[model samples]
Target: MIKGDSLMFRGRLRGTALWGGSLLLAGCMLNIFLQAASLGMKFGAVADWVARYPALYLAGSLFLFFLLLLFAALVPGGYPGPLLAVAVVVLLGTADNRKLATTGEPLFPWDLMLLKNAGEMRHITRGMLSPLWIAIAAALIVLLLYGMRKLPKVRMRLTWRLLLGGVSAALAGGFLFVVGSGSSLASSLHYENLYWNQKVNYTQNGFLFAFAGNLHQNVMEKPDGYSREAILRIAAKYGGNGSEAANPAPTGGTQAEQDAKMPDILFMMDEAFFDPTRLPGYSFSADPLVFIHGAAKSSPSGYLLSPEFGGNTANVEFEALTGLSMYFLNDGSVPFQQRLVKMSSLPSIVSILKQRGYAALALHPFDDTFYNRNRVYPMLGFDRFTSEKDLPKAARMTPGGYISDLAAVQEAVRELRASKGPAFLHLVTMQNHFPFTSGKNGPNTIAVSGGKEAYRKELETYAQDTKLTDEALAELAKELKELPRRTVAVFWGDHLPALSAGIYAEAGWDAKPRLKHETKLMLLANFDIGAEGTGTLSPAFLGPEVFRRAGLAEPPFYQLLDRVKAELPGLSGSVRIGSGGNEIRKLTPEQEALLSDYRLVEYDLLEGKQYSAKLMF
Candidate 1:
């Protein structure tokens, strides 16, 4: 009997060892598969990565394997746990791939927030997942479910299962904490967190590791010596006792007369608008931006240094409205989804104009739920918000199924005409949104040459769409000219269109970081504010410049921005265009002082206490 019991125990131990070894191997394979998928399913690239940085790759695989182990331990039958884990990783990897293709940036943690509006974002995500792909995914899921059902279940004692799960969960949790918290262990292990350029980070480090690093992104760290006293001192220097010294009223009018003369401001942030004529070694059949070129000749127009590339329109809009620099925040964060929804009110151009008796209104020819704009607009101090649902069917018509820019402009005009007081209308058009396919706009009118044959369709489609936007702009300028009230319009593109990475590479735009972020900016008005010549400026500085050009009293924060604008005209996360269009690699002492003050004030307003809130805004 004793000999029989000993043999039985040995058999059980062998079975457990085999099961554990198989689970470990499966987890490692899944991790490698996910890593390769992140790099566009290039297994040779994964091999090259392993050959180059074996230790880092090993560590990443171990982290992922431990997570899989924890998931396995959670279930009574281990087969379903690995299946669930695979599904989760596959979904994330597919999303990251699509986002990278569209936006040139990998998926960040904040992007998960957009999943809440998945139904509303069909316009952008429509062609990403085709029927074939969906069918394949469904088949795979069904196969996995069948396999899970057929697999034999391992029966373990309740106490042993609890211990196994607790141990695995602890190990997974500890690893993430050590790595994410930037502890000495993470540093000693040579874990690099390259959050700034996530594309390279994901390719070099494993995607799972790179993505996990962003889980604890502190969007804006508090500036050094950030205190109420420091904020007060900065405010005292630039606030100027709430006087409009930085932006004095126009010479011809009293204070009240200046207030009355303030022009109704309209900001039209066009979608994916750019001058294709600027592309080197390429010729268009006709000038797609003819009207805009003529308008820019006399208006305050230049390349607006956008903070985004192909997507994330809200970031550019945030900078233009709030005078806040994305340079100060994390690279991959969306302030609208991540920060603004948490705040009750934010000091912005909308709030400033509202304080000056201008009725603030926001109009976007898209779903309000996108980027949580419906919730964010009110916090930004807009008195009214208009979205696609608010418009009539005629106003919402577009060849690409997005609302047309002409219709959006007409809506803006209607709102301005109906308003009793001076209005500040911000209209974000959706006509030129992405997925520039052939015949989407009913036969492209624009012809393109001198580029790869593969990109010709996208190029022609984008140019044709841009031409429509230019026509809309011409119509808007004509309407504004006929208005009885003086009106000023700030028209600009949020970013360059994602017309295939090959086009930008062929044009040599990818060689320069600034070229990828630069977009057309024009300031037009019925009355001349004596603004002329093309110049480069950051979107953050555009708000204060608009206030100054409008001859309106700027709040203290904008006055401070005006000073910073003189020193650092164009600023973004990657590059800074200093005074006279020269890029500044290093700042002078005076520029440093100015930048420090600006950082302090920004920190105070955004992350620190509300010390300068009442004084600045």
Candidate 2:
């Protein structure tokens, strides 16, 4: 019974069982949490059937989860913990996507409660909803307890061989931790804590968190997506004559005194419209925006350096609200969304306008909650937000609650006319989004409606509606032309429209160049915000330029914008100047330092989830 060989074998078995059980517990817990969380998201709601057969589901899921952990732990030098975490995240995310596709259930992060389709969530992010979790936890506990019982007995017979084994395990653990921390593998370990992770995806960060595409919406998560030059320019915070600083008008006059004299502000941005110079238009059914831009103020738009090109309007919105690009920081976090508590945005121009006796209101036909817009608009200092739910039932026909751009205009006009002060209206149009075809799902009520279907049909109707928007803008101008004070209106694309990747590829193109991610910006109005009726199209200068042109108080940051333009005179005319040296390249040290501050501030706010309503973009 006490043979040396047998006793030695028993001691080794006890040690292996102890750690193995520990690994199993961690694996299952992480696996369940990730899967349940995935399922709990709008994207995974369709996979509720996995829970229908609890016993079978528990058995199958754990077998796979435990097997991987076992392999990882047994491997001589493997990245077990971090890799396991990512695998679970991806596996569960994929599961939800597949189940949703198969079940014909719509799945997306924000679709949880807003969705009216059939069925309900069967699992929650917490383990309680998953019987499999319960099973796995119980099994691991039993194994751990069983291993513990033999632990004391084994120690009673401890020998040199046993001591050596224990030391080896400790060394291995330390080594594993060091290796894991040095590589990108560990970056994703605590990814959930990121401020912007809710919508900014890291789901496809290519085996590690090194890929920033999920955050920058950079194609394939390349480093080129973030321009180091920009981050080093502004000290990571809004500075100089920009709107965030309470600089007396870049020219002069308190906002309050400028009230009766300053014009009302109207703004719009197109989606996914990258610069033609950065991404030329070789073939097109129509150059609709270019045609529309003919009469608008034209300038070389500043380097937007956006995180997303084809989509992610929220990023663009953040840039405009705060007058700083999100390109410089960890694209993994979103300061505008959950982390916005106390974050500072350009002092709400709307709030300042309101103080000057101007009415400030925002209009968007989509669910206001998509970007956590409901939580943010108030923080942005807007008095009211017109979302799709606020629209009549007839207006909710389109996907994404895209009523009609004109409807938003109508609502904006109504609110403006009724408000007690001069009005500042921010209108975000939706009908002309991606898949620019036509359809039943698009807005039936249109000034100019297209009759097609799917995401494309919405786009067709959207372009048609643009003419209406133009006409409406003209009409609004006619109405405000005689207002007591001057009226200033600004319209620009948030980003360019998304064409079929195949079609974009087929149009005598690389079929896979980086341009697919860049978009053009349009800044249009009947009034002259540019002093010479001359300036280029750039996101960086829009706020200050528009403010200065309108003869309103410009912030210090805005003044720097003008200085930037002066240094890079040719920035407005083309993506490339006579030489490679451009404005972005010639940033002054002060500017570079400012970018550092901006990044630092962003990093701090995001790292510490301290949100404050005072920071409005």
Candidate 3:
């Protein structure tokens, strides 16, 4: 019934639609295949192994397609399946690649929080675009756009369309619900089973499955042996009756006399700042930590055994603030993101100081949202929190793209000056954070005496950056000297700088993770507040020690800390520093008993019921 010209036109349109649609579908499949192959390759999987692992590609495609379908239904789009599928592949692949390169671990659900905070993203290294992937993605996008125009649109009745869309959404929702509840299945799986070492689980089960498995593990349980009676028995041994009594007046003075002598106490956690001269075979042209050395002579100063190395500043802060050791918690789990969420009351240094009329302020020269600190601070009992957003101006950054330590000190001093009465300020600086490469540092100001040329540049950069922080310390001390109110400052490095593998080998430190974990600590006060004999102390003990030196009423756990410090001067999840030196040695019977008690108390506060906390605090 149609004319020759009209029939031919219709035939051409049909052919174009078929070819474009084919191209789009093929592109989506190819994108998923490539991404799965890339993830496999990261774990040293060969081509043969990847060819055998068909389920990975299939599961990824199905989940991705369902997500796209749900997104399309929510909007007015009519099946953006291919485009969205390709997008999911590219984005996830890119993020996983970058995370693996930086942290040597695959991306997990917690990392999503980091991506939401733009300021925290600065800490991560941005990956460059792969030309092959980019070219393929571009081709897919073009094909998708072309197909969208020519493809025949199937018209459905309005009611049918709505019903079909709802069905699609319900299917997606149901699948997600299954995933959330499938933890028991994962527990039974062979290599994919959740364990203490999360890296192993990720390697065995693949990133997607392992991430879901971790979500189930987030719910902490009581220790293997936990009872209120046992907790009380331990508390009684330490002279703690577990009563919330008002702080008794000082033995030698009245409450008014104590008030007159109370000083503004500040705890400053300097990031990646350490005494690099501790290296076995390295020497510098001049002393890098000249100021710290001078301070050590007069003030209470020594090494501190940090719970982590290079990163995990939050954990070190956790132990210092709350007297809980990461050693007892799941390995590499973030307390702020994981455990702290469930806690309503944390017996932290901030809270202890607050009980004695000190306004507690939390200060950090970075995003308030990183590690969910803005939320966590309230639970820790901070009166106010000042982050980069609250600073007078945007933070002044170093060449390494971190906020300068000098600027952070200035901000802390400003806040202290503004506070009305005795204050407890916790400040975390960012100047000396990791990746000590030439690009990050301005210039090699310090000269290295011995090292391969490859390591010399990086070492010099770290040393130079450390010197800058030391200079900032000197500046801070000068500023504190001028403050009208008596002030006590606790300055300590969070952990050592993350150096290159070659440098560690050259310095004879390759086999020693414990020695590498040591960082310096110094407690200095403008007025004479007597604190004696500091060889090394764990971060947990540091808080009570600071309170004692500042003439504040001790927390209920002070007795426990004193006993532990007498035998084990420093201890963490990994390393211990005793009178001899840093070592990964077994705990003595005496030490074990103390550790058992410490663990029980911490368990009660963080994980178990709060019956013990009420008595203790």
Candidate 4:
């Protein structure tokens, strides 16, 4: 009986050892696969990473192992928990790789909010999930489940399982809190947080660590010395009551005459529009933006520095409409999604125009629910919001499954004609959105030479789309010129196209952040305004600039923007341009003071009490 008991005890001990070894092996495999996905399947790079930072690599593996254990402790079956954890890591890693490749941006914690709009994202992710990938994913899931069923299960009491789960959760939560807080513990572990450029941050630090760091990003913090009195002092410095001094009244004009002279204002934010010719190593058959180039020559036109590069059109719109710089907000935070949803009402160009008797209308030839624009447009004081649902079937048709710029402009003109008086029309077009596959709009007229065949095809398609937009604008200009009522239009590109990073590298386009973020802007009017070029300016400054050019009254906040513009013409989170259109490496004392004041005003309006709103707006 003693000999039999000894043999059974030995067998039980061996089973425990086998289970522990298997868990360790699974953990190591999960880490390898994750790193492979993060590095785009570059095995050599993974080896270099392991060799360079062995300690970090081991720590990352252990971190992932603890997470796997957390799942295992909660799950009844031994293998199912680890398998589920592996599947999740695989999905996220592959998604991060794909996003970085296509959008020139890395995945962030805030990006999870996009899952709510997955149906709308089909247009952007058209070819991402091919039949082959779907089949492979299904097969892997089935295999994992089957393998889990075949594996041996370890029996443990419910109490011990719960205790293990609790411990694992505590450890994971503690790690995330320390890393997310930007504490010295994370720094001592060589975890770098590169807020400005997240792609590099993820590549340098592991993806798990880098992604955790953005969990606690403050959307907008109160600027130093921000208070009601300080805001009043700044407002008084500019103009006490948000007067129209910056926009002087035409001589010998009555108030009614001045009101009548205020032209119908149209803001045309074209999607993904930029001059491809500016990128070196690419030759086009003809100038794609012929009409735009011609209009720029005789009107107020220059490069508008966009805060975003590939996507996030709404942020650019927010800056232009509200005159609030994205530079002041946390990086990767979407104000429309994160901040605007909480506020009941906000001061904007739309609200100001509505107060001045100009009917405010917002038009987008796409789903209204995109970026939650349907709910937020009313908060911005738009009297009418039109989307694809409101348009006729004939007007909504397009070759690429997106409404054409011509169709959108036609709709805008129709709205303007129906309005009883002067109107403020904000039209956001959707012709040149992402996934610029070849032949989407039939044969491409623009021939692109110099990049890989795939990139060349994408460039060709993008250029043709922009050409169509230019043609539409030319038609709009002709129509506006014939109208009896004078009108002023501000047309600008929201951001650059999501082309391949390799294309930009080959063209030397990635040498400067400014070059990557710069897009075209033109201020055109049916009647003659002055021949003042905007030079280089941010979207936040565009509204004030438009008011100045059109002889419209500028509010106190806009007046402050004017002062800021005088010192720093262009300001983004990453780059700043001086008044002379040169990039500023360091700020002068006066420039610093102006920036501080700008920050305080922006903070008060966006985050603080209504102390400045009555004075500035």
Candidate 5:
């Protein structure tokens, strides 16, 4: 009644289904085990706390297992029969594909010798899947062997269509191995896979999934007395919020004369202001940042040790505001991007001034909102932020079309003076951002001197922008020099503009000091702060030095930062692999203890738990 070959046909199909189903289930378990092992071995193993994620992890594991089971169980020959011949060959090939995608990395199953204890543990887990899979294949093989014993008798009896279906399913399983692994496995691989995420992502303290509550909490959580008192003692002792809170009221400072009371503060970022190849004592003639260098009460300025190379404006900005260097934490992620911004930074400075009865405003003629600065500034404690939308736009010095840095300065100065009381106005410039292609085709840059002729047109336009900024500062300084309130104006480049790799290559400089030229900071000051000098800094130094010059009390983390500085001696120490002529990436217990001591000190200073510096050591 069911169809042709009734009883014999049904028995054949049932046997095939059972055999195929068992093999399919084994394949799914094999997938999870393989992924986890590869993650551990390749990108430095992840912590073990992750194993506890039952909802997401366990469910995912089961789903994969069952999907494979369903595919096999529905086979024409259900259990230990001809159907198994299709399943065994499929699992073997899928395993090989797993080997291919995880190549180049340490995992690949074959590189088990290189794995550490953690990788070894995971490798074992993956290996467990091996025997189980092998066992499934053996069972299927047995089923196929049994079916073959009767195959000569049955093949003559079964239809051609059923044979075709079995072959097709087996081939599909092999295909999944080849095409469905590695970076190509899924689109979600970029931000999702814990392994690749660590290798390539520049996000949250490495891979977020690596953490499994406290289970994966590797190393010791509190190894010694120093680490036990992380936030309060260490922070206040160093220069943290405890000290931040302990500092005298922001309003207690001695009042300057009317002419000196509310002087303007100007900060400038010279775009592409670097020269690695100096044509040997060429004097490189002309005022690249000369107007600022010569006219300003120059102290001793030098290149800053910075965190970013090609482009990382936020790194510079973070240093400028919080005084906490981004280098203290591991270098993969932005603390602010995470819920990790915890230092006494720009916001605190502005808030202090505001609490002290001052007007605080920040102005950057570019999109002030470009880097979520609107939110960041508010968090940093500014009363107002003026970006390009709020200010009139002017042609930039570079192809990026940023407003002239000078324009931002003039606009800020004019606006702040209209307000009452002491004020903190921060200004960031444009024009010197990038794409150093401005005026390249225009006649305007023809007269510029110094630098390269290849960059002649671009330099001409940039010089004009630089001069404009200088002219504005000169006028402002001249006016403030006699103002009623004693004002402090500070100007420095955010970052030097960088031409493309080709430009440097064409200039025949293979070993130029690219990092040195690109990271220089130009400091020009008027009023009391200007006397601090034009010395170079690692931005880590900028905070302490700036506050010290401003006569403001150091933030809570000051003590710890100072101690850290003594070890590293510059801002770059915190972020770079090298510091104070030493190479140390991960913190030693001794260093962490020392830093934790500072954290505890700052905790005592700020009188709060969250006041801990975001990530230190």
Candidate 6:
């Protein structure tokens, strides 16, 4: 080859390389800017000021650059890496925005599971396809395809390309280790002052870095000085009598004498069931929950401080059955996903009942695997779980596409009757699951005065369905009253419904974060079991309290729970209920002292070694 011709070829190659490099940098910058803007827009601002935070911008950019470079090395043709990077950033931004809009929370890895059942969630996804998102997605697709074609292809040997790919992979891993590890690398990257508050953390640091922080956050942090010794001490302090402490015997003679006395205990969690009067200035014609109000007066009834609102029913069920609280665990982490798999003996009320020769049956009017409850219930000591598969679909009544509470109660009663001995039956009702748009509005007995037209319509639907739940409860009470054997029934709402923001605003209620966490609880017995205590109770305490009010001896774990309940009548992720039944936003020193011990015990039982397991569980 002639020297002049070779030199010209070399010059052209260098020019192409320079242009390709420039294009890659531009794509990287655009991706970074778009991500920052998306998060900033959530808080009502553009991310123009991110220029001032050079360190953060560099950290995010460097991470994206490594990802793009890795893609470049793997693909033989021109700049597939840059295009892919842009696509990734846009997808992430869109998902986060939609999630925040729907759930009032940021997107986390756990939420990805919801997408697998996307077909079942048309009610939610129908309104999620925003025109703005579609426009941005279309624009990104054009840029990606154009850039992929227009960029010059770099001619490199296979060996050299492979080496470059290796190097890029290593650098990407190192960058992730530093920033995502949430340790020294995160500290060096100016991420030292991080907390579990996803919104605040995501706003301060961009989505990529904040998501890394969340990955670390899911690893349950061990409380200081947590050990078997500490747990034993705490349990001894609170665990009143040993598990052998005999509860009030039924009709039988001695504690050892087992006979016709044991009441068939039933627990029913009504979906989105609560007294509408709890809302300020709210009035309903003829009082939909009138039966529930009268029942509460006769039984032990008050508001329950649930750990979640709107959804996450399994978590509430977990606490009631296992006597564990989500307040001490990682936020947004579902127990059925994380801890239930590892659990051997999840000291549940069912397990306690099983030990006393009672059959533990779980009845749900939905798919068994919605929350992995089909597997989780057995782990929690349920002998049998009756889901939609086991039931006759024709007999199932779904008012709003959810099984009616009345049907669930009827099922529970049937199971109780079938059992020759006492049964611990837990029925999780689904009459009022969200998207209150199904079935007829049903007479419109309840009216929502203030709110947007759409919001008011939703409230009316929710109210009507809730009234159905109330009637279902009354029907169950009547059925149990007619039973030959005495029975005790505990009815509670798992959480409040996810009503629109406008309805909350129109109600003139406190905008405190914990304002919606409280739901109603009622304990009714067919026969007298002495005076029933009436006040607010936490879900973890509900099982123990039922055993207590029913004159049944609780296990050591429930004994500690009973002690904790006396001091803190109700506890939730956001609110604390005092002995006087007042929901306080902040904890007092004394309340903290009471809760600290309980927290330590919970840690030992759930995350730490089972030092107190023998004593408690």
Worst 10 residues of 4 by lDDT: 242-251
Candidate 2 — which residues are off by over 4 angstroms? 1-258, 272-294, 297-307, 341-348, 351-357, 393-401, 440-484, 508-538, 564-617
**Residue-by-residue lDDT tens digits, candidate 2, 1-617:** 56998988987787657755655565445444444443444324323423433332343344434444434444322233324443544444444433332221212332322233222122111111246645654665565455445433222233543453455456444424433344343333332223234222323211112222222221111222134333334322434322233543223476555555656677665444443323232322454344445544452233233344445577666656555445454433344543454344434455556545566688887667655677777877788898766876524345443465556666666666676555778877765554344552343333322222332334445445454455544555455545554556665556544444333443344443223433444334445545244333344445665677666765444444455544432222113221233325355676544444444433423442212112222
Off by over 4 Å in 5: 1-228, 235-244, 250-266, 269-285, 340-347, 393-400, 438-476, 504-514, 522-525, 528-534, 573-608, 611-617
Better of 1 and 2 by TM-score: 1
Q: Each candidate's TM vs. the true structure?
A: 0.90, 0.55, 0.80, 0.88, 0.55, 0.85
lDDT of 4 by residue, 1-617 (tens): 99999999898789867876777777777767666667877888988877876665666777777788788898877668878887888787777877766666677776777777777776767766558668878998998888788988877689878987898888878878988888887788787777656676777777777788777665677778988889889888877564433234344566557557778899999998988889888889989999988888798889889999988899999999999999888667678877786788888888777777688999998889788889889989998999978875634324547888888888888888787777999999888887777766557998988868878888998888889889889988987887667788888899998877788888777778899889998887888887678898899998888888877878888988999999888899869999889999999999889888888988887788856666777
lDDT of 6 by residue, 438-549 (tens): 3433456677765467876777778888888888889998898887667998889998876665666667643754557778888777888554555777788888788777
Rank the models by TM-score, top first.
Answer: 1, 4, 6, 3, 2, 5
RMSD of 3: 5.2
Ranking by lDDT: 4, 1, 6, 3, 5, 2
Assess the local accuracy of residue 553 in candidate 4 as a C-alpha lDDT between 0 and 100. 77
Query: Model 3 over residues 1-617: C-alpha lDDT tens digits?
Result: 46988998788677656644553465445434444433644434533433554554345345555555544444443545445655665666666655554344456666666777764565643223347657866886787787667655534356755775687677655544445566443234332445466655555455555555566565344665689898888777776676664353344576556655668888999988888888876778888889988877778888778877766688889989988777777655778877786678887777766766778999998788878888899999998988877765644544437777888888888888998777889999877766676756466678887778867777888888888888888988898889878898888888877666567778776577666777888887778866564777778888777767877666567778777777777776566765555553877898888878888888888877765565555
Best TM-score among the predictions, by candidate number: 1
Model 1: which ten-residue window has the lowest total lDDT? 240-249
In the range 1-617, model 5's lDDT, one tens digit per residue, is 66667986888777556544554565444434434443543422332422433333433334344434434344433333324534532443344323322221121121221233343234222323446556866786686677645543322224443454466456554333322342243233222333322333212212122221111211112223434354444444544443333454434345644324334444444444443323231232355455456653454355565654434456576666555554443333343433223344433455545544567788877554445566678777777888777865555444434566556656766766676666777776655554444553132422554445655555555454555555666666665655555566655555544444444444554364334333545444445455434334555556555555656655445545555655554445223332444434677676666555643433332323444533221
- Candidate 2 yields a Cα-based lDDT of 0.45
- Per-residue C-alpha lDDT of model 1 across residues 4-94, encoded as one tens digit per residue: 9999999878877776776777667766776776787789998998787777677766766666666677877766776787788778877
598: Cα error in model 1, Å: 1.1
Better of 1 and 3 by TM-score: 1
